[model samples]
Target chain A: MGPDSSQDAQTISQVGEFGLINRVTSGRAQSPGTLLGPGDDAAVLAAPDGRVVATTDVLVEQVHFRFDWSTPHQVGRKAVAVNLSDIAAMGAVPTGLLVGLGCSPDLPTTVVDELAAGMWEEAQRVGISVVGGDMVSATSLTISVTALGDLQGREPVTRSGARPGDVVAVAGRLGWSAAGLAVLGRGFRSPVAVVGAHRVPEPPYEAGPQAAVAGATSMVDTSDGLLADLGHIAAASGVAVDVRTELVEVPQRLTEVASALGADARHWVLTGGEDQALVATFPQGRPLPEGWRPIGAVVEGEGVTVDGDAYAGPSGWEHWR
Target chain B: MGPDSSQDAQTISQVGEFGLINRVTSGRAQSPGTLLGPGDDAAVLAAPDGRVVATTDVLVEQVHFRFDWSTPHQVGRKAVAVNLSDIAAMGAVPTGLLVGLGCSPDLPTTVVDELAAGMWEEAQRVGISVVGGDMVSATSLTISVTALGDLQGREPVTRSGARPGDVVAVAGRLGWSAAGLAVLGRGFRSPVAVVGAHRVPEPPYEAGPQAAVAGATSMVDTSDGLLADLGHIAAASGVAVDVRTELVEVPQRLTEVASALGADARHWVLTGGEDQALVATFPQGRPLPEGWRPIGAVVEGEGVTVDGDAYAGPSGWEHWR
Candidate 1:
C-alpha cells in the first residue's frame, strides 16, 4: 500500500493529487452502467440512445461563490445545478457527469466530500448519477463539471427552431435566484423565501422533455435572464419574440427584495439569471403543457421585445464578469 | 459585450476568478464538435464512435509550474500533455480537450494567450482539438484539462492484462523531463537538453495504438517514472516485473545534474517520472516496433523489482505534496 494509506486523518493535499485520487478511487465498487469509468483514457458510457448531450461549466472561488455568503454545500449545488440546467436546455435527460476539480491545498478534505455530496444530491433529483471525477490542487477552489445526457431518441430542441407565430412559454421560477442574491448581498437574513431561493434553485428539469414531447419548435434554458435568453433564441432562430410583462407573475419574495434593494423587480425578472428555467416556443395551434405559462409570442422581426418594444434595464448574468 | 470587456489589463487579484475567466474565453472560436459548448445547461458533442476515453489533470501555479520559473506556454503544454498521456495510456486517440482555467485577474492577458497558444500547439502535435473550455478568476493560475479520445473500435488495453511471460517495453524519452526538472531546480542555465525536456515533453502519441496493434496485453503512461508505473501494472495484473538496469540508458544531459545534486543517474532513469512515455507488456517471442525498446520481462511474482531486487530511491512523483 502507498505510505499515506490511512482511510482518515490524512489530508488530500499532503498526499498530492495523484495520491489523493488513488485513495478516493481505490476499492470503490463498480456499477453496471459504468462500462469504463475513471482511470482510463476516457470514460466509456453506454448511450443507448444514439445521440448524447454534453455540457461543461466551470465555477471559480470568489467569482462564482463567496465563502462568506455560500456554504460549501451551496457552492457544490450551484455548480452541479448550472451544468444540469445546460443538459435540460438541450431537452435531454442527464445520465452522467465528469467533474474536474481544482482546490486549494489548505481547504478541508470534508469540503470536497461535501461538494461531492451536493453534486450527488442534485444529480439524484434528476434521476441522474455522477459517474466519475478528478481532483487537483490549486490556489483556489473550482468545480468543472461536464454533464452527459441521453436524448432518448428525440431530436434536440435547439434555440434556433422557433418560427413566427409560435407561442412562447416558460416553466419554473424566474428571477428568484437573482432576488436571493440581493438578500445575500445586503446581509439580510431570515427571509425563508429569499434565502431558500438563493441556496438551491429549483430548475424545472422535467419541463424540457415535456416540451419536447409537446412539440416545441424551439427551446432554451433561462440562464441569462428571460429577455437575454429569449433574445438568443430570437437571434438564433431568426425570428423576433415579443414578451408581455403582464404575464410575469412576480413572486412576493422577489418584490420584497426589490423593495429592500430599491431595485426594480422587473429587472430581476427580465435580466437577473440563474433560475435554470425552461422556455420554449410552441406552434399557435398546439396547447402548452402544464406549468408552462404563456408569456410571449414569436413574431416576424428579428430580436426580442418586451411588450413589442425594446424595454430593458439590466441584462442577464455572465459567468466571468 | 460584458463588463469584462475592459482590455483585460486588471491584475489577478482585482476582479477575482469570474472576471479573469471572462477575459480568457471571451472570443475563442467554437468547433463543430461542440453541440452546446460553453454556456448552456450542458454541451452536446458528436461521438461517432460509441465509446469515449476520458481523463483529467490539474496544474497548480507553484506546484505544477511556477509563474516565475515556467512560461505560460510551458504550463499550458504540460497541462494538455498529461491529459493526452492518459488518453494514450488507454490506447485511445485524443480528439478534443475541455479546459477549466482559474487564474489571478491581475495576470497579463498576453500570458494567458501564450498559454492558449501553447495548448493549441501541443494539441496540434497530438492531432487533437480544443473544443471548449471555461475560464474564471482565482488566487493563482490553475489549469485543469479533461481529454476525450476514441479507441477506434479496439478494446481498451487495461492494466489488468499483463501475464507472466510478457516482456516489458518503453516508448518515448525517460529521465529527460526529470533531468530537466533538476536543471530548473538548481537554477542552472546548463543542461539545455534537460531544460528543454522540462519545458515540453514529447509523448509518443502513436506508440499506444502501435503497442495495441502489436498485441500488448497491458499498458500505462510513465508520468510518475518507469518503476512506479510498472508497479501499477504489476499490482493490477498480479504479476511481477523486473527491469534490467544494465539495459537502461541515461541520456548525457542528466550527468551534470546527477553530479551536482549528488544523485545516481540510475535512480533518475528507473524512478524518475513525468516523461509521459508509454510502457507495455508484449508476448515473449514477439519483437516491439521501431519506437519501443524492450526494457524487462514480466514474471510470476506480485511486485516490481529492478535487477531482481527492490531498487528504490525517490519512488515516483506525487502531486499536491
Candidate 2:
C-alpha cells in the first residue's frame, strides 16, 4: 500500500501525541546551529552573533487558509515562509524554528505528515531546521511558527532607519500572489503561475542580508503590499515615501491575467501582498544590490504615495478591518 | 468608568489589529535583554551565552483551560509560565518571549488587554519581556508562547545524563496545581491555595540553573507529574527511578483537602501535573541544591516505581491517550 493510503487510514487521535511527535522528528537532519534538537524540553541553537532575532506568525485554518484551495503541505510551507520572511526583513539569517500546532483530533495523520514535510522543505531552503515544536488538540488547525535568526555581527536594519534621502528598492516577485488569489476567487484556477504563488510564496530570503551588507538603512517584507508596508517605514522614520509607478515593473504575465479578469495589473503590483519580497531603502547614487530594482524614494513628510499622489485603491490587506 | 467597563465595551474587531497591538505594547518596559521590542518585523535579544534555548507550548480554550474556572489574565500567565518553565528545564534563564494569539473577532478587547498584562507580569518576574508576537483570528482562543533563554555559558542539563547511582530531587510545590485542578473539577473554589495554583503556576525557575551548578545529572520540570516526568528521564538516560513514598512530602493542606473530598493526597503528589516544579538527579554523595529535597533514587532498570512498587493510579496526563 502507498504511504498516503496507510496514513489516511489513521487519525491524529489514533496516533497519539508521543507517536505523532516521533513521526515528525525522527530521522530528520538538523543544521549545525542546532546544538540540541527536539525531544528535550527545549532546543538549543548556536547564536554566534551574541544576539538573536525572533519573530512569530500565526496561521489559522479557514481564516488564513482553506483546505479546499490549498493542500496541507502548501499551508505548512506558507506558514513557515511568512515567519522566515519576517526574519529576513530584519536583515538576519534564520537559524532555527519552533512550531506550535493545534488541530482537531479527528484530522487525518497524513495531513500532519505532509504539513511537517512542507515545513522541512522551506527550512531546508535556508539551511535551518525545525528544532522544536508543540502539538496539541484544538477545534481547528492553527500553525504558529517562531523563527530565530542570527544577525551575523551586522546591525539590524529596522523600519525607523529610513532617512529622507534614501532610495527605496525591492527584490523578488510582486503582484503574483494577489493575482493568483483573484483567479482562485473567480473560480478559474487554470493559471498555475498565480495559483501556485498563492499557495506557496517564493520569498527572496538571501536578499535581506545582502541588502544589509550593502548598507541599506531600512528593510521590510512585502506582506502588506508595497504601499502599506512602505507606509510603515515612512511613519517610523518620520518621512514620506513616493513610489514612481513608471519604475515599478508590472510583469506581462500578470498584465495578461489581469486583462482576462478585467482587473488592473498595476493595482496588483502596487497593493498586492504575501509575495514575501524584500523592500529596503539605500543611500542615493549608490549602485543597487544585485536582484534589487529601484521603485521609489523617501522624502520629508508622512505616509506613502504613488507617483507623488495617493494610490486610488485599497492600499493592502488588514485583519479585522 | 473603570478600565474593565470601558474595555469590555470594545470587541477585538472594533479595536482592530494595529490598535490592539498598540494597546498591548505601548507603555511597556522592555528588559535589557530585549535589544529590540515589539513593533518591527522581528525583535532582537541578547544571547550572552552564545547559544539560545527555545521552546514553544500551545494552550487552547476548553482543551487546556476553561474561562469559567480561570480569568483570561490567569490563563495568559499560565501560558507564559509553561514556556518559561521549559526554558528552565534546560538549566537556562529565560531572556524573552514571543506570543502567538488566535481568538475570535467578537471577543472583548478587555480579555486581550488582561491577557497581555498577565503575560507581562509573569515575564517581569524573570527579568524578561514579551519581545515579539503575532495576533490572528480564530474560532476559539488559542495561545502559543515561545520562550528564548540563555545558558550563561553552562552546559545545558539535558534528560539523558542521569546515571544509575544518582539521587532524584525536587524543588518547588508538587501536586499543588493538580490538587487545585481536582478542587475545580469538584466545583469548589474556596480553597484559594490549590485553586489559585490551578490558575497560575509558580515554577522554581532559579532552582533549574542552581541544580546545574550543583552538578545535576539530569533535570526536568514537573509539567507531567513527578513520576511521569521522571519516566522521561529514566527512558532517556537508560535508568530506572524509584520514588520513596516516605521521602515524598504530601503537604498537610493537600492531605486535609484530599480527606474532605475522599481523594488521595499522595496519589496527587505522585501523578498530578502542571505544578512547574523542578526535578533533577544529583550524584549520590553530593548535596542537593538549596531548595531541593531528595525523594528517590536511580538504578539499572526502566520506568518509574513508587516505594519499590508500581503506583496504582494513572501515571500522568497525556494529550490524546
Candidate 3:
C-alpha cells in the first residue's frame, strides 16, 4: 500500500489521539522548505518566495457535517479542502497545514484516524503536508484548519482589481455541491458521482494559477453562491455584474440530479456554496483559457444579475443562524 | 475616539452579529503586507517571506473558559493568544488571522464586540491583522481561530533538532495559567496578578525570533506541560532530557497561591500548561540570549525527567475526561 492506503476506519478508532497523530505524520516527505513537520509548537516552512499567502476555516460537526452523515475521512477531506480553497483563491500553491481538533472522548480513536486519513488524502492531492495540529476534548467534534501557501514570485489576486469593463468568467462548475446538498437534505442520495461531489469537493485546483498567469484580476473562490461571490467583486471593484445565463452551461450531471430531486438547477447554481470554483475578471479582449467559460461580464450597475435580470434566490450561505 | 472606543458593552449587544463584525472590520491602518483586510471569500495577504506559517486553535466556553470566570474580551484574547503562541513557536512573526465564531443569539452583542476588540488588541501586538473570519449560530459559544505567520528568511524551529549535548532553555514564565486555573476551580480568586494571568497569558512573543536568531536548534511553546512538550522533542530528536529542579525558578506568586489552596506549586510548575513560553535547544558553548534561561540539557535517553529522577506528578492537562 502507498502512504495513503495504510489507513482504515477500524485502525483509526483504535488508535489513541496521539497515536493517531503519529500515524498521520509518519513516512511523509517534507518539503525542503519544511524545518518542522508535527509534534511541536508549530511546523516551520521555507518561504523562498519572500512572502506568504494565508487563510483559515473551521468545520463543526452537525453544522458542517454530521457524524451520521459524513465518514471520518470525508470530514477530514472537507476540513482541508475548504482551507486549501482559500489559498487557491489567492492564486498561491499551498505548502503546509496546521489542524486543531476538538473531539469527544467517546468518539472512537478509529473515527479520528479516519478523519486524519481523509485529511492526508486531500493534503496529498494538493502536494502539501499536514504539518502540526492540536487536539482537545470537547462536547462535539470541531476541526479548525489553517493553510499556508507559497506565492512563488507572484502578486496575490485581491477582490478589488476588476475594472468596470473587465470581462467576468469562471473556470469551474457551479451549483453542483448545492445540488448534492439538496438531495441529501431531502433524504435522497444522488448518483455515485454526484454523491461523491457532496462527500468531497473536487475543485479545479490548478485553475486559479492558470487564470493568474492569464492576467486575471479580482479572483475569488466561490464557496458561496456565484451571485453572492460576484456581489463581493461588484462591491469591491465598484462595478455592476451582468451574467448572461444564455452563455452559462450547467453540468449535465447536476441537471439530472436537480431533475430527480425536483429542484431548479439554476437555484443551485445561483446559491449553492462549497464548490470552491475560481471566478475572476479579465480585461476585455483577453483570450479565454481552455477550461474557462465566459459566463458574465462587468457592467455599470450595483448588483449582480443573470442575463441582465436580478437573481432572487437565496443570496448565500449565512454562518450565523 | 478610536475605532474600538466608541462602542460600549451595552450598545454592543444592540449592534448584533453582523453589526459587530462590521465594527471589527471598520477603518483601520492595515499592516504593510495585507493585500486584503476582510469582507471577501478570503482575505489576501502578501507573504513577504514567500511562505505563510499557519496554525489553528479552538476555544469553547465551559471547556476552555467559563463565562463566569472570564470576560468576553479575555476569552477573545486567550483564543488569539494560544494560536499566536503556535506561530511564535514556529519561530515566525504573525501576519494575519481568520476567526470563525459560533454562538447563541441570546449571547450579548457587546460580548461579541468585546471579543473582537480583544482580538484586535492582541493582533496588533504580533504585527498581524484580523484578515478574515466566519460567524454562525450554535448551542454554545465557540471561537475557532487560525493564525498565519511570516518566516522572514529563517527556517521554522521544530521539535526534532536537539542533539545529545545541546543546552535546553526557556524564554518565558511557566505554570501561572494552570495555577490560576486551580484557583478558579477551587472557588478562590488569586491575588490581582495571578487572577489576571488566568484571563490572559503574557507569552514571551519576541523571544521566538530572538531564540531563532540566537541559533536555537529546536523550539516549542509550553502550552502543554513542559515535560509533555519536551518529551515530544526527545522522541522526535532521539534524545533524553533531564530538567533540574534546583534550577527551576518557581514564581513567588504561584507559591502563595499553592499555599493558600493547599496545592503543590511544583506540580503547577512541573505539569501545568498554557505558559506559552518558548523552550528551545542550543549547541554546547552557544550562549542563550537575554530573556532566556538555561534549564537543562539533552542527553541520550528515551523520556523526560526532573532532578535526575523520573517525576511522578499530575503529568499534564488532559482534554478528555
Please write out the lDDT profile of model 2 over residues A1-321, one tens digit for every residue: 898778678989999988999999999999999999999999999999999999999999998899889998999899999999999999999999999999888888889999999999999999999999999999999999999999999999999999988999999999999999999899987599999999999999999999999999999999989899998999999999999988999999999999999999999989999999999999999888899999999999999989899789899987877
Off by over 4 Å in 1: A1-10, A14-19, A22-31, A49-51, A256-263, B1-42, B256-262
All candidates' lDDT scores? Answer: 0.77, 0.94, 0.79
TM-score of each: 0.88, 0.98, 0.90
Better of 2 and 3 by DockQ: 2
Residue-by-residue lDDT tens digits, candidate 1, B42-101: 455666566656677777778678766678888889889988988887887876777777
Kindly report the docking quality category of candidate 3. Answer: acceptable
Worst 10 residues of 1 chain A by lDDT: A1-10
Model 3 backbone overlap count: 18
lDDT of each residue in A140-244, candidate 3, tens digit only: 677878777766677777787888788888877788788877777887665766666777787787877777778888888888778888888898888888988
lDDT of 1 at B31: 51
In candidate 2 chain B, what residue range of length 10 has the lowest lDDT sum? B1-10
**lDDT of candidate 3 over B1-321, digit per residue (tens):** 766665443343345545766877887567887876776555667667766677777888888888899888988888999889888887888888888777765666777878988888888887777888777565667788888787788887878898989999998888788888888888877576777788898888899988888888888888778888888888889899999887789989899889998989988887888878888999989878899998898998878989778888766654553
Model 2, total clashes: 0
Query: What is the DockQ score of candidate 1, to 2 decimals?
Result: 0.43
lDDT of 1 by residue, A12-92 (tens): 676676665565456544444557766644566666664467666777877778777777787778888888877777778
Q: Is the docking of candidate 1 incorrect, acceptable, medium or high quality?
A: acceptable
Model 2 chain A: weakest 10-residue lDDT segment is A1-10
Per-residue lDDT tens digits for candidate 2, residues B138-244, read 99899999999999999999999999989999999998898899999999995999999989999999999999899998999998899999999999999999999
